[model samples]
Target: MHLSHPTPLQNIMESKTCSRRGILLPFNSYSSHKKDAQHCIFCDTTFPLRNFKGKAVCPTCSQNILKLFLEREVR
Candidate 1:
C-alpha cells in the first residue's frame, strides 16, 4: 500500500506546536459594542456586563465553574 504525500498547508499545520485556542470574538460583534464592563468573580476579567446575562460572572468563567462542578459530581 502506497501513502499519499501531505500538502504544503497540511505539513505546516502539523509542524506547528501551538494553535489558537479559547473563545474567539468578532470585531463587529455585540460584545465589542458594549461600553460598560464588569469584573468576573472567578477569572476577574473585565468583560461586558451583558456577557454575564444578568449573572455575576462572565459566560466563560461560568461555564468553566459549571464544568468543574459537574466533573466533581461525576467523580
Candidate 2:
C-alpha cells in the first residue's frame, strides 16, 4: 500500500459531537462572539441570552422588582 502526504487546508473548522443528540457541529478554536452570553443591565452580570429575549434586565432583577411593586400595591 502507498500513502500520499496531506494537503494544506486553510480556515477549516474542527468538528464537535453533541453529547445529547449525537450531532456533528463545527467548532472553532477561538470564539469571536458567543451567542449564549448576555449582559444583564440591572445586575451587571453575564447570563444566558435565552432567559431574556429583547430585554436588558436579567430574571432575578426583574422578579425582585416585580415583587417590590406588588407589595406596594397591596399596602
Tell me the lDDT of model 1 at 37.
51
Worst 10 residues of 1 by lDDT: 47-56
Q: How accurate locally, in lDDT, is each candidate?
A: 0.67, 0.58
Q: How accurate locally is residue 41 in candidate 2, as Cα lDDT from 0 to 100?
A: 59
Candidate 1 Cα misplacement greater than 4 A, ranges: 1-37, 50-55, 68-75
Q: How accurate is candidate 1 locally (lDDT)?
A: 0.67
Best by lDDT: 1
Collision count for each candidate, in order: 0, 0
Tens-digit lDDT track for model 1 on 1-75?
654998888888886856856887657765675575557766677654324455567667676877856877998
Q: What is the C-alpha RMSD of each candidate to the true structure, in Å?
A: 11.8, 11.9
- Encode model 2's per-residue lDDT on 1-75: one tens digit a residue: 544743344213221332345668987644545664557755677653235456666667766867756877999
Q: Which ten residues in a row have the lowest lDDT in candidate 2?
A: 10-19
